[model samples]
Target: IRLRPGYFPFVEPGFELDIHCLICGGKGCSVCKYSGWVELLPCGLVHPNVLRYGNIDPDKWSGFAFGLGLNRLVMMRYGINDIRHFLSGDVRFLYQF
Candidate 1:
């Protein structure tokens, strides 16, 4: 996994998390854009403005946020070639998971 700088309106310090491509085992693949890495998460410390908006003391408290790319994770785990399969209403593919 790797962490790289990122941006989000609600977060002050954000990072993008990436993992080695499972489909090609870090060699290369279209899924990874031939970079051998697949983004897994976007996470960061909560911005002070967000905390203040929630009536929390930004100076006295801090928080963080993260979102998991479940579909991507599953795709990497199962070597699925297309992400649309998850959105497709086909039980034939959905049942496998």
Candidate 2:
């Protein structure tokens, strides 16, 4: 529903956020993998001390992050016979979608 810039240890800069799909109106949808939403990205500001600790300038650096659930969405879209098919390398099933 909202996105905010922040920081994380693993990433120089991090962001936390939530998104609603216009197509689904926040309801479950094939496009959203029945989760009713999609991830935009996780991005944030680089800590001045963190950049300096890494020997990089805080002023010149920035970053962002996000994740996708590709397989889940595919299943929802096609009504696949099984989730295993996605990784099973079956051409027949893949073509239908």
- Number of the top-ranking candidate, with TM-score as the measure: 1
TM-score of each: 0.84, 0.38
Query: For each predicted model, how many residue pairs clash, with residues at least 3 apart or on different chains?
Result: 0, 5
Regions more than 4 Å wrong, model 2: 4-7, 10-14, 22-24, 29-35, 57-97
For each candidate, the alpha-carbon lDDT, in order, equals: 0.92, 0.61
RMSD values for the candidates in order, in angstroms, are: 1.7, 5.6
Residue-level lDDT tens digits of model 2 in 1-97: 7766655665655666657754566787655567766555555554577667888876887544355445545554555434578788879976876
Candidate 1 colliding pairs: none
Candidate 1, which ten residues in sequence have the lowest lDDT sum? 74-83
Candidate with best lDDT: 1
Model 1 misplaced regions, further than 4 Å: none
Full-model lDDT, candidate 2: 0.61
